[model samples]
Target chain A: MSLTRLAIKSLLLRPARTLLTIVSVAASVAVLFSLLSFNSGYQEGLQKQMQQMGVHLMVVPIGCPYEAASLVLEGGEIENYLNESVAEEIAGMEGVAIAAPSLMHAIVRPEDGRTDIYLGVDEKHLELKNWWRLNDGEKPGPGLLSEDDAVLLGWDAALIEKREAIGERIWVPEIESEFSVTGILEPTGTQDDGFFYVPLRTAQEQFGLEGKITAVQVRLTDPSMAAEVADALDARFAGVEIIRMEELLGSMTALMDSARALIFAIVAVVIAISGVGVLNTMLMSVFERTREIGVLRATGAGRLHIFSLVWTETLALTVIGGVTGLGLAAVAARGVEAVIKRFVPMAPQEAMTRFDPHAALICVLAILGVGLVAGIYPSLRAAQIRTIEALRSE
Target chain B: MAIRNLWRSYERGSETVHALAEFDLTVQPGEMVGIVGRSGSGKTTLLNQIGCLDRPTTGQVIIAGTDVTALPERELVAFRRDHIGFIFQLFYLLPTLSVAENVGMPMLFARAHDRERVRAICERVGLADQMTALPGSLDGGDMQRVAIARALVNDPALLLADEPTGRLERQARDEVLDIFDDLRADGLAIVMATHDLEQAARCGRVIELRDGRRLEHAYEDSWPKAHCAT
Candidate 1:
């Protein structure tokens, strides 16, 4: 008997039109919600990865430093190498705390349908990757960096190679070498979980790439002096480029912001279309119910009553659509993340879309705003209907 | 209730057409007055003016000592809500609403819903068994009864019905007229427009119109002591 109930019943009278309008709103809202969730989750994942890196700058051979840094962090074969002496020279710099030089080589086994990534590092590299922890029951010493022919297996690598216990030896067919496992690193939720770590000299000698390393990861005594130290490194190093981690983060975020702007524009257009659809549906409902509205007027309903009845229907449509859209976004988050990764540069290993309550709330408010705007004209048209004309309408 | 010198006109292209010209009528409480005419005879127009659904071009409509014609649109709506009720010839029950809901609609607009009163009115209209049924499921008679329950839910001083039984069968029409008889006996004034001369004859007084003007000869011949002021 309430206006709201009456409005809902009216919408139910034309079930197909109401459902179609709701689905359109839901589609637009789903896109908007996914965009917001991806924005928040991508930024958080990027910042966490940067913090976990524990390095301020990286020195790589003269090339696209961003590509080189990504390759090194993600364990890919490098086309060029930097001399191991760069690590020593960077370590001697005034603000440098630890310069961890690492040589990354990937051995692709097409027959096995997988690639094995090997990282050669000295003791300083262990300091830069301070989050690494040895597996349970393994003695935590100075690690395997100083041990000859000793290899530390990442959690996933150990599982794959069946080398779960200390003293287990793994034979590398590519390098024609057999190395004993000194430790197994616990899962670090990063690319490190899939790498095999060996002593720097042993890898250099076994791979026949002596005194050559892929990159030098540098931690600073004071992070604020990053620009000055990068300048000093640039001036001193002839065949190397210094890539500041903060600058990389900023550039990547800016790139994502641009992509987000494009996506937001698309979502805006979709939402506008949804609003138009709602307006059209409500307008049609008003036209169809002209005589009914006249009967209400004759029964003592004021203009406000008629107006609010129509307005209530619009709002009901959007609120239902908004909630349904949020559920759709939540269910499709992983699929959306996979598709986004194909287009976005340097997507993190972790999930890129997160369910945020605040973002959901914003989407709800936006749809309600859409409802308010879309309902105005139709409600006014219904309200301003002359009673006699409406009653006379066929 | 009193109506004086009422005029309702419209312009079709360049010429003016009066729907109701210089019409006047008065009905006492507890009286049932019927308005009868052929097509385009201004029966609906007269009811619209009396129900405050339309404004007369020049006239005074005084109900309960207030000149409702002079009230603003907002107050006029409130006046209609509080003092007047209407039933249409087509029944006009909202298809989506159940019988009880249709009856409670006027109270919904008035912002004062009494479940007891709605039930009582449904019972009075012999719709007590059909309270939960939707209008679409009801026959024409039941639908008309629901409309009657809706109009009387507000306890109005005057009721205006435009062709209330125009679409009903003979049995249904008699059932509706019986409800009107009970309402008139309860001291509620009613004005109905109908095309059925037999039904109009049962009213305390019947007024006939032609071309928006009263047919004085027909009125004088039909009822010698007609109380209406022409």
Candidate 2:
């Protein structure tokens, strides 16, 4: 019998096991791609968010690095503060071009109000630092408490307060301080969407803390001078620390790199395991089809012919499994796209979530290689089976 | 003589099987012989050795002047394709292929044979009508006819049949016997292994084997069976 027909029949003989192997390998590979998506997507989002907003330095209070980092990144608590004078002091420093003082604090939801909203900083210097271009409303005025009676809501902040932009009044519960929404910023999949922005004086007054703020961000005259400015600031301000944007990015990227490495290791191990799976399945098939192979051998099929019959069969099975797995993954990505759409309407494009076709092709080629190599030794074994033994194997 | 020094062969293990012990056989350019033996009589093993599907451990198996017993496995395959035809009891037709494909299989592998000869063999087997049908759909007699066509596709010099009538009923067996008679009339050399004495009686000569040796050769029967051999 020709190897093509033989292989197809052999694989089709045990439909469930072959399909199960296909699904298992596909799942492992999909998970690998999922990790790829997460690491690259997250890293891309962070860099893109930073690129859009050109803030180069972030100065926060000493101790509690993770929490403070999260606060500035994901708006973890909005409840810390640094002096407004610090911005002025840093602005006079040699390499510093602009020092923007920002207040970040939280207030309890109003007792009678139906939402659990908190008030975060909405500083002019903070907005200028982030280049917070608005979709609506005017910029905050440039005086202490100048915009204290007003606020700007981000996409998620508006949902939190259950209010709309342009003339919605909300009260802060813990301090009985009230403000109106004056501006709304666009969605960027960054921290801005979760916090409310207001004047530093207004946040201090509302939270009942005076002369205190969270972080003082500095912009350098030259972008390359950021590390030097950060070092100088760290030396100048005792009990305070300076963080360059690049450093924050490097560590975040490192965390993602570790995840990438982990997935790489997992993919290698699973492929090896599947190689054994291919071998076992083909071996059983070879044993069962001994009589058939012998018949062919007796009919003048050469050793190469016998070997190719085995090799082709192995190739066909693995390639079918690989393709089916990828097809399922394509369907799975649609589901993931839908879930992400429900959360971030202006999320990154769906193409961003797709696996690169080359990578996908590589996965398929890897699967084919796994199948054939896995079958190579077994095929040779089948070829070595004597014609008499094969004919008599019964 | 194509070859000489032929001897008996056996495969031994714990069972001590003697497939072809102390047996001397010969085939000239044109001859039709019938071999009759009971199960375990080694008729099929003897055919396998002559067919080059196996090598005799101690005997010399020469086919068309080539010492096939000592030939390498690759050349042995080529030897079988080039010189021998095999007909099995189960009618080993590939189920997925059409009748024509099955007939074309040996020719395709042999490759040295003419393609028109393959078409002519199918026509001779009376399978021209059923050439497009797969083996799965053919009746027993027609299937045997296809098997005969496959055996004749390469126009091989030596035809070996191992109980070709064993799987068929009396009518189908008789139909297959008719084809064998025709081939003998056409002067094709045939060695058929069968368990039925009545079928053996129809051939030009009958050789009865026991204990892996030829017990008797009824050459006188050829006078009466001469009409079948034409």
Candidate 3:
């Protein structure tokens, strides 16, 4: 029989202990997989969101920049509004390319009591937001801007109302108006998919705030001129805040880094604890097999051979557990994604737990490293056992 | 094989205890040498030293004209694998392995035996019919036979058995003795430690140990001793 075979049989001698050790390692691996999957998915989703925003700078009323950000990014409710005339002033500023004005509103349908996002966009606004796509008819033109009876429905908005929105009329109970859909926007798997879009003049007329806008989206002629233009705008536009998109994204990246560090710390602690479990199991195995070790030594087995036997057993357990843990974590992640999608509507649709090949490779290597380190003391104890003393042990 | 001025000592709290003190002996090939001793008389310690399982505190052990005491640990392991076989009072069979696998185990470490050679050795030890059975399923005699097969599988020059038949019935003990006689007839050197006078009488030379020292003819029993070969 080979030494590897002997080691495997030795572990099989106590099925319960072996299985428990494997399970401990499995739990550690599962935690690592969950953390890494979430980290990768969250980072990727945030990058997509940042890319979809398209605008380089945002102008919001003073003291509620975050609320305005949430209003545009998350379709959150906001009461702040800036004068529509600010768009013309921003358009005329140095290094400004496009100034697309928009208004945000939230109202609960009197019929269903469900809240929905309502957005007002000028004809030029769609040209600046590159990610938007029409699933059906063309966007509302300048003609529709003066009509106040046309609308575009987001994909999820149609799904929520169970309406075929291409030619359907929908009632806006808050504004007490009925509007015909010009088109339905394709699903972007973002906040945009859950909104109702109308012409800026129509929204202004319906809300009776004809001369006000919620935010002005600015695009720089050269992105490198963003800091200077933002500072100029900040100085000239009093009682309003100018936010560079890159700065917002940078802070969000920093927040994610902190979250990643915390998750990795938790993962490391769990793996260390699992390593201790492997050490304990191996030590107990060595103690139980004292006589067998003595017999092998007496039969001319060397110290290295004994050491390798115990180490091999530990590695086998950990590797098997690691693989099993990965499979379990992947299935669990899918379940978690389903639960989140059903319960948390504001969560980014693309930001679900996912494991890529790179994360899997890292987890496998880490578990093997844990196995090697944890197996050291016990294998050495097995190797250094005195043959006579071991034989004398019962 | 010869041992010169051998001593094995260990610390017992504040004092030192010598398990084997200034032991000297030599044996020839084809000879069965018996060591008769009382409990705690250093018989097991002497076997342990000769088997290279423990390092001596002070001494020289020359096996086949090589000074094993001066050999490094790695070399000692190689020397032991190639030169010595061992048997224990408890049969010392790995319970997890089948009879054949237990016999083939030393060869796994030595990296020198094939399946046919293992089968042949098992047949010679008279355990051919029990090769597939686990040691736990075997009777006392069969387990000892498996241990003998394991020792002989590597064809070592010296076979050191510590109370090889101590745990066996009379029939099993006689059967083990017959195997020892066959091994001796095949020109193999055997060193066995035992308390049974009948077992000792069959050996060519019998030495008795008491309080870590050796004495010739220390027992007053009228036991016949076989003549040693020159």
Candidate 4:
């Protein structure tokens, strides 16, 4: 018979105890992997969300520091406007690739009869945009919104409308506009989802303001020159505030990194508890089988054979536990994602919240290592047992 | 093989209990010798020392020209596996192993020249059809036979049987004696520990012990009335 069969049968001799230990260790691995997955998912989701908002630079109309920063960083309502012509002057400078200007505005209606909408401009001056990628159809053509007919909406905006209204006109009662829905943008789980799109001229004209734009989005052909581009734009635009997308991405990344580290520290303690369980099980088996060990020694089994048998038994249990734990963690991760959505609604919808196979593999190997080392003390004690005394023990 | 002035003890804690005092023993190759003693007597201890299961405190146990007492613990294990076979009162068969497995245990571990020969010997012990049966289901006599099969399978220079018949009834005891007769006829040296006088008398020689010291020696010529004792 194979050594594995021997180990499994040996463990089966005390079926209840062995199974309990396996479960305990497995639970530990599951907890560790689950926490690890959660941390990674959050970090990944946060980074993806930030990147989706458009990277590299944010140029806003400057005034009060918090207002301008809030307007550029978070999605602040129309406080001031940065003109479109000023963008052209910045674009002619070095380190700029594709520049698109947009007017950012929010329409608040009653959530409980409070206005609850954030609208955006999809204009001809920025129609061939760098960041507003079209996942479904072509961007609304020039003058699509000029005739007060067509509009492009985000996916969540369409979902909130309570039906399939593409190719039909939908009304945003808060803004009090009746615009035809041409297409739905893909879900990016950012401010993009919370906003609607109309031609920039239409938005300016509707808001009773003319010859005005919000801020310019500039993508550097070389990402490494983002800081240089931000500084140059700041120098050229007088009162305009330049917020580099790199800085925003860095802050978001830092928040996620700290959160992940916190979760991993907690999981480490849980894993250490599980390691103790493995050690306890091996120790108990050695204690009960002292006579059997002596018989094996008498039967000409070497010290290494004794060591291997014991180590294999523990290692086998750990592997079984690790794999089972992974299965449970994945099942739980689905529920966790649902809960996370209830709180952080902007978690990247495309980013999966599930146990990672790469991380699970590493956890399995680490547990097996723990198993081998755990069995050593017990195996040595078993090996050192004097055969004559062991055989003669009652 | 000869053991002169053999001494041994079992010290668990503060208590030092003498297991065997001074003992003198001799047995030629292919001879069957029975060791008889009471419950507390060192019959088992004497057998254990010669079986290489224990060491003499102050004497020598010479088996096949090697004083096993002087060998290292590692080599001692090798010596025990290769040169000796054991049959215990409890029929200490590996419960997980089949009858064939139990019979083949010593031979398998011995790294012997012929494994099929061991199976052939197992068949001679009357377990020819029950080779696949686990020990838990076997009767007392059959279990003894399995242990005996293991003891003789490796064809060791010395066969040690400790109270092999103690766990059996009179009929099963007689059955075991019948198998021992075949072993003796094949000229395999066998030493058995027994409390039964009839079992001991059937051997070519019998040594009685009490309190770890040898008390009497009864050879076939000395026990002229052994046939009548049964």
Q: What is the TM-score of each candidate against the true structure?
A: 0.82, 0.74, 0.79, 0.83
DockQ of each: 0.71, 0.34, 0.64, 0.39
What's the candidate order when arranged by decreasing TM-score?
A: 4, 1, 3, 2
| Winner on DockQ (2 vs 3) | 3
Model 3 chain B: which ten-residue window has the lowest total lDDT?
Answer: B221-230
Candidate 2, residues A1-394: lDDT per residue as tens digits? 3447655655665678767766666665564454445445645665565566557887877767577655544424544456667777887899876677766654433454433323434344644545554565334344312565877777777876777657788776556778788766666466667767776667677656677767777767787788788888888887676777887657656765765676567678878887888788778878887887777776767777778778877787777777776776666876655554454323445244576566576677778778878889878988888886787777
Task: Candidate 2: list runs displaced more than 4 Å.
Answer: A1-6, A9-56, A59-151, A154-165, A168-180, A186-241, A334-353, B1-3, B8-17, B107-119, B184-187, B216-230
TM-score leader: 4
Query: Per-residue CA lDDT of candidate 1, range A227-295, in tens?
Result: 999999999989888888877667877877887787778778877988998899899999999998998
Instruction: Give the poorly placed runs of model 1, Cα more than 4 Å off.
Output: A59-124, A130-141, A153-216, A220-225, A228-243, B217-230
The local lDDT score (0 to 100) that residue A341 gets in candidate 3 is 49
Chain B alone vs. reference chain B, TM-score for every model: 0.93, 0.87, 0.93, 0.88
Candidate 1 lDDT for residue B44: 88
Please write out the lDDT profile of model 2 over residues B131-226, one tens digit for every residue: 889887988888989888888777778888888998888998998988888887786788999887667777777667786777753454463354
Candidate 1 reaches a DockQ of: 0.71
The TM-score obtained by model 1 is: 0.82
Model 4, CA-based lDDT: 0.72
TM-score of chain A of each: 0.70, 0.62, 0.70, 0.76
The full ranking of all candidates by DockQ, starting with the best, is 1, 3, 4, 2
lDDT of 3 at B52: 88
Kindly list the per-residue Cα lDDT of model 3 for residues A1-394, writing each as its tens digit.
Answer: 7877888878888989989888888878977887777777767777777666778898988766765655545435456678999999999998998899988777655467566777888876876766676775454344434447877778998888777746688887667899887777778776778878888888888877788898899988887788999999988988888878888778777877876787788888988898999999999999999998988888888999999999999898899899988988887887756553463223466646977888898899999999999999999999999888999999
